[model samples]
Target: MKKVAPPQCLQNAFEENGLTQIDVFEFPEGTHTAVDAAKAIGCNVSDIGKSLVFVTETLNPILIVMNGADQVDMNKAANLLGLPIRKAEATEVRETTGYVIGGVPPFGHAKPVETLIDKKLLEKDTVWLAAGTPKTVFSLSTRDLRDVTGIETGVDVSA
Candidate 1:
């Protein structure tokens, strides 16, 4: 059987964002959820960077990159963005981010999405994130991730 390749969108992102040093990986054991990804990568669940999508009342998409062990506090997220927001539906998540739920990368979005990182993620030197596919992932230093995303300071978005 041929090995699965990481999505081209993820490749495009590497070139676009100066991430040539990072390598995308495919773990066939199903890294569709935080627990699954952690087990596959042999890392702590808190080291998994889960990219989540939310929709504001005005229909804008927001990407929150947080640790797998944490949950986004809706009230804090709303306050941080200065708007009311709710979880985006699967269709909306796909339509807005050009990726499906459970596969959304922190970067490489189809459109520019307002992004916030959970401060806890910064505590670790490196974290693993989805790479445009549920079974694909890539690791990045917390510092490089901040530089790439242009969000140097993380927020306490976790519950």
Candidate 2:
């Protein structure tokens, strides 16, 4: 079997932002959630950064990079952004981020979405994220993630 390489757009974004080496991994089928991803990658669940997209009341897309082991506090997120929160539909996610639920990267979206990085991720040396597919993931440092993704580091959203 052959491995599918990551998209050039994401690679370019990483390079343009001076990111370190990006490690891509291929797992078995149905490994979409973070727990499954952690098992596949042999890492702690908290090391898996889940890239979530939410639709604000203004119909704008907001990107939230959170710890896999943590829960997103929608109320806090809504309060911080001063916008009503609605679960972003799958179609909205694809339309805005150009990636599906399990494979949304912090960067390389169709447009620049307002990004928020979980403060907890800062404590980790590296984190794993989906590489445009449910069966694939990539590893990079927390600082590199923020730099490459242009994500603002914050603690607005809590578990």
Candidate 3:
């Protein structure tokens, strides 16, 4: 199979972040869902890092990177963030992240939105995440993920 290149947005982000080791894979079958990405990558669903966007009560955008096996506990997340939160509308998501809902990547946003990663994802040595497109994904160690994205250890925002 010919290796398809990652989207320019992802490529620029990876290069700018010095994530030279990251390699993006094309999933023609589609990786729009965690289950599909897990099956394609031959990993547990929990190892797929799902990126979700939310709007705070202040109308600010925030990104949550959680394990595929878990769901965000909005109340807990709100408490942790010290603000009420709700899912971002499609327009808000695209405006904030420069990507659509099913294909939002962890980094390379149009703007630098506040980000929180689920602690559960840190338990794994490696994890997979969307790469600027529904049909592309990339693998990285949990440590490298945090480093590249400038995220701290993580938060217990998953239920």
Candidate 4:
């Protein structure tokens, strides 16, 4: 079997952001879900940074980078952002981020979207995130993630 390459968008973003330490890994089986990624990488599920997209009441896009072990509390998240929020549909997610649901990274989006980092993810030294493809992922430290993504302080938006 032939190996698959990482998505160009993800590659360009990593390079432009100076994420020299980020290393993309590909799994033959696939890592579309947190459980799948954790199993493939031999890490705790919480160490997987799940990038989720949501739509604010006003129809703006918001990106939430949460720990795989956690679940987003829409009400609490809405309160934090001061706007009612709902999960983005498949089409909406692809259109807004230019990536599919299982492949969206924390950054490197086609356009800028409001971003929030889950505090739980900050507790880990390293976390894995989708690399613009379900079969691929990359690792980065918590601090480096914040620096590269330009995300400020983490928040308690997960339950």
Rate residue 110 of model 2 by lDDT: 74
RMSD of each: 1.8, 1.9, 1.3, 1.7
TM-score of each: 0.94, 0.91, 0.95, 0.94
Ranking by TM-score: 3, 1, 4, 2
Give the distance in Å from residue 35's predicted Cα in candidate 2 to where it truly belongs. 0.8
lDDT of each: 0.88, 0.81, 0.88, 0.87
Candidate 2 to truth, TM: 0.91
Stretches of candidate 4 exceeding 4 Å from the true structure:
1-4
Please write out the lDDT profile of model 1 over residues 10-108, one tens digit for every residue.
678778878877777888887889999999989999999999999999999999998999999999999999999999999999988889888898988
Of candidate 4, the 10-residue stretch with the lowest lDDT total is 1-10
> How do the residues 1-159 of candidate 4 rate in per-residue lDDT, one tens digit apiece?
124556777778878878755668888878898999999888899999999999998999999999999899998999999999999999999988889988888988888888999988988898999888788888888888888877768999987
Which of the two, 2 or 4, has more lDDT? 4
Which pairs of residues collide in model 4?
A: none
In model 2, which regions exceed 4 Å deviation? 1-3
Q: Please estimate how well model 3 matches the true structure, expressed as its whole-model Cα lDDT.
A: 0.88
Residue-level lDDT for 38 in candidate 2: 90
Residue pairs in candidate 1 whose N, alpha carbon or C atoms collide under 3 angstroms: none
